[model samples]
Target: MPVGYFVTGTDTGVGKTLTSCALLHAFAMAGKSAIGMKPIAAGCENGKWIDVERLVEASNVPAARELINPYALVQSIAPHIAARQTGIVINIATVQRAFKALQEMAEVVIVEGAGGFLVPLDDRYDSSDLARTLGLPVVLVVGLRLGCLNHALLTARAIHVSGLSLAGWVANQIDPHMESQAENIHTLQHRLNCPLLGVLPFSEKIAAREYASLLDITHL
Candidate 1:
C-alpha cells in the first residue's frame, strides 16, 4: 500500500510548506524515497509557482511538474479567485490522478495543502475535500501564537468531521516572542486527540533540512 500524508495548517502562513519540506527531508534521512506534492497553489512569480518549486527542491524523489502541482494559479490570492481570474477551473479529479501517479513512484508522498483546511479550491470543493479524496492521514501545522489555540481546535474539529484521521500535529513557533509558549503547547496536547509530533522554535531563516531532524516521524 502507498503511504503518505496530507499536510494542512491552522491558517495561511503557518509554515505548511516548511513542514512539508521537513517531512521530505526526514523521510530521506531515514532512507525512504519521498516526494512532496502541492496539488494546488495560489501564488506565482515570473510564471513559476514558489511553493511548488520549494516542494520539488525538498523532495528526494523526482516527479513531473504536472504531477507535483496540478493547479498553478497565476495570482497570489485565494485559489478560487485565482482560478476565476485565469479562466481555470480547479479540478479535484486531476489532483487525484496526479496523486495516484506519485504513489507509484515514491515510498512516501507528502501533499501540502494550500491556505487553510477549509480554503475553497473552487465553488464546490475545498482543501478538506481534496484531503478526503486522497484518503491520507492529516498532519496539521499549528502556528503557535495568540489565536493558535482556537484555530488549532477548529481545524482539528473540521478534519474529524471530514471523516479523516488527525495523524499528528506540529507546533511551528511563528511567533518568537509569544508569551507562555510552553503552556499553549500543553493546552493543545491536552485538547487534541492525537500525538504532539514536535514543536519547532522560530527561525529567521528556513533551515528545512535541519528542522527535518526535529520532526518525530515515528508518529507519522
Candidate 2:
C-alpha cells in the first residue's frame, strides 16, 4: 500500500513547500522511497514556473515535475483566480489523477496544497476537496503568528467537516516578533487533537536538516 499524506497550511507563504521537502528528506533518510506532489503551485520564478520546481528539486529525482506538480500556474494569486486567468478548470478529478499516478511510483507521498484549505481552486473545489479525494490523513502547517489560533482552529474544523482525520501538525514560527509565542504553542497543543510533530523557530540561519529532531517521521 502507498502511504500518503496531504500537507496544507494556515495560509500562503507559511513554508508548506519547505516542510514538505523536509518530510521527503526524512523519509529518504529513513531508507524509504519518498515522493512529493504539489498538485498546484502559485507564484513564479524565472520566466517559466512556480514553487513546484522547488518541490521537484527536493523530491527523489526519478519523479518528474509533471508528476509532482500537475498544475503549475504562473499567476501569483488565489488558485481560482490563477485558474481563471489561464482558462484552466481546476477540480478534484484532475488532481486526483495526478495523485494516483504519483502513488504508483513511490511508497510515501506528500501532497502539498497550494494555499489555505478554503482558498478556492474552482467553483466547487478547494484544498479540502482535494484532500478528501486523496483520502489520506492530513499534516497541517501552522504558520505561528498572532492569528494562527483562529486560522488553525478553522482549518481543523474544516478538516473534520470534510470527514477526514488530521494526522498531525507542524508549527513553523514565521513571525519571530510575535509576542508570547510560547503561549500560542501551549494553547494549540491543548486545543488541537493531533500530534505536534514540530515547533520550528523563526530563523534565517537554521537549515532544514538541523531540525530533524523536531519532526515525527514514524507515520511515514
Candidate 3:
C-alpha cells in the first residue's frame, strides 16, 4: 500500500500548504517518491491556485493537475460557498478517486485539507469527513499563536472522534511577537498524544525546502 497523510490545520492561514510542501520535500529527502495534493482549493490567482502550484513545485513525483487538485474553486471564500457560486458540488467520491490516482503515482502522497479540519466542503461533508474518507493518518498543523492551546486540543479531539489517527503535528511559528511561545508548545507537547514533528521558527521569506530540515519526518 502507498503511504500517505492528510494534512489539516487548527484554522485557516495556519500554514497547511507550507507544511504540506515541507512534507513532500522531507519524504523526497528520505529517498521516497512523494507528491502533494490539494483536493479542494477556494482561492486562485491568474487562474491558478498558488497552493497547488507550490505543491507541484515541491513534489518529487510528477502528477497530472487534475489528480493534484480535483476541485479548484475560483472564489477566495469558503469551499462550499465557492462551489455553489461556481455551480460545482464538492463531491468526496471524486476527491477519493483523484487521491487513489495520486497514490498510484507516488510512494507518499501528502494531502492538504482546505481551511480547518472541520471546514465545510459541501452541505453534508466537511474536511474531517473527507479525511475520514481518505482513511489516511492526519498531521495537524498548529499555528503557534494565541488560543492555539484550545484550537490544537479541540482539533485533536475532533480527529479522534472522526475515527482517524493524529499521526503527528507541526508547530509553525507564525507569530514572532507572541510571548511565551515555548510555554505554549511545551504545554501542547505534554497534552497532545503525538510527536512534535518540529518547531518551525517564524520566517517570512524561507522556502518550504528550508523548513523541511526542521521537521523530523521520522515520527511521521
Candidate 4:
C-alpha cells in the first residue's frame, strides 16, 4: 500500500505546509521515495501559485507539476471565492485523478490542505468533502499558542466527524512567548487519541527542510 496522509491544520496559518514539507523531507531521508501535493491552492501572485510550486520541489520523483497541484486559483482568498473569481470550478474528482497519478511513482504522498477543515472549495465542496473523497488518514498540524486548546480539540472533533483516522499530530510553536506551552501540550496529549508525533520550536531563521530535523519520525 502507498503510505499517505492528508495533512490538515487546526486553523489557517498553522504551519500545515511546514509539517507537510517536513514529512516529505523526513521520509526521503529515511530512504523512502516521497512526494507531496497541495491539490488545491489559493494565493496566487502575478498569476503564479507559490504553495503549489513549493510542493513541486518537495517531490522525490519525476511527477509533473500539474499532477501535484491540479487546481490553482489566482486570488489570494478562500478557495471557493478564488475559484469563482476566474469562473473556475474546483472539482474533487480531478484532484483525485491527480493523486492517483502521483501514487504510481512515490512510496509516500503527503497532501496538504488549504486554510481549515471547513474552508469552502466551491458552491458545495469543502476541504472536508475532499478529504472524505481521498479516503486517506490525516496528520493534523496544531499551531501551539494561546487558544490552541479550543482549536485543537475542535479540529480533532471535526476530523472525527469527517470519518477519517487521525494518524498523528505535530505541535508547531509559531508563537515562542505564548503562555503555558507545556500545559497546552499536556492537554492535547490527553484529549487527542492520536500520538504526539513531534514538537517544533519557533524559528525565524530556518527553512522547512532544516526545521524538519526537529521532528522524530519514529513517533510518526
- CA lDDT, every model vs. true structure: 0.94, 0.82, 0.94, 0.86
Q: Estimate each model's TM-score.
A: 0.98, 0.94, 0.98, 0.95
**TM-score-superior candidate, 1 or 4:** 1
Q: Distance (Å) between predicted and true CA of 75, model 2?
A: 0.7
Clashing pairs in 2: none
TM-score of 2: 0.94
- Candidate 3 Cα lDDT to native: 0.94
- Of the two candidates 1 and 2, the one with more favorable TM-score, higher being better, is 1
- RMSD from true fold, candidate 4: 1.3
Q: Write the per-residue lDDT of candidate 3 for residues 1-220, one digit (tens) a residue.
A: 7999999999999899999999999999999999999999889899889999999999998888999999998899999999998899888999999999999999999999999999998788899999999999999999999999999999999999999999999999999999999999999999999999998888887489999988999997
Count of backbone clashes for each model? Answer: 0, 0, 0, 0
lDDT by residue for model 2 over 1-220, one digit each (tens)? 9889899998888978778888877777787787888888877878756456556666774776677777878888998998898898876787788788888888889888888988888887677888888899999999998899999999999999999999999999899999998999899999999989888778875345556556887844
Better of 1 and 2 by lDDT: 1
Off by over 4 Å in 2: 48-50
Per-residue lDDT of candidate 4, residues 171-207 (tens digit)? 9999999999988999899999999888878988536
Residue-level lDDT of model 1, residues 1-220, one tens digit each, is: 7699999999999999999999999999999999999999888898888889889999988989999989888878999999998899888999999999999999999999999999998888899999999999999999999999999999999999999999999999999999999999999999999998888889998888999989999987
Model 4, residue pairs in steric clash: none
Candidate 4 at residue 4, lDDT? 81
